[model samples]
Target: HVVTARVVVIIVAAAMVVIATTPVRSMTVVILTVTPVTTLLRGECIELETLGESGGEAFCDRG
Candidate 1:
């Protein structure tokens, strides 16, 4: 089966919309094995960093 790039993009956009609207704390199912949109505020960049072996941070603090 050949999956076109356009289709994939549309799917991703739809998923992002869903994530953006839903509240983070109430979400049960993980979106693509990662946390849904919460750390990133409107007009912010999403950044992910590893603090320690088991510690990590996801935020939208650009600077």
Candidate 2:
């Protein structure tokens, strides 16, 4: 259930970028893996990724 929520968040963030006309510096959102790598639910890590300024690619933020 939690992982599902993460996907939803990423979708919403992406949509915002599409709807915005003015150039945005960057957009960030959390996404999750489909299959759990851990037995515990909390083990599902949220991947925080940022979209590139060009709007064609994304890079993982270490911070």
Candidate 3:
């Protein structure tokens, strides 16, 4: 009984380590893989005031 309990504890500890490390390793890979693709899909963004005209200079077509 004691030996079985020790084996179970060791198995649980190893599983815990695997589970903890899996997502961390996956996250680094996922971020590195997804970041550039997402950025490419997301292009430039012009604010509402900046799109047309503000106090500074005209951006839209004045003609």
Clashes of each: 0, 0, 0
Model 3 vs truth, CA RMSD: 20.7
lDDT of 1 by residue, 24-46 (tens): 83244335523333322211232
lDDT, model 3, position 50:
50
lDDT by residue (1-63, candidate 2, tens digit) is 467567656666665665474335323211222123222223222332122232212221211
Candidate 1, residue 63: lDDT: 25
Index of the highest-TM-score prediction = 3
lDDT of each: 0.39, 0.37, 0.45
Quote the RMSD, in angstroms, for model 2.
Answer: 12.8
Candidate 3 versus the native: TM-score? 0.36
Location of the lowest summed lDDT over 10 successive residues in candidate 3: 54-63
| Model 3 per-residue lDDT tens digits across residues 1-63 | 345446546655655666577976755655554465334323211332355435212322221
Worst 10 residues of 1 by lDDT: 39-48
* RMSD, every candidate, angstroms: 11.7, 12.8, 20.7
- Backbone clash pairs for candidate 3 read none
Q: By descending lDDT, how would the candidates be arranged?
A: 3, 1, 2
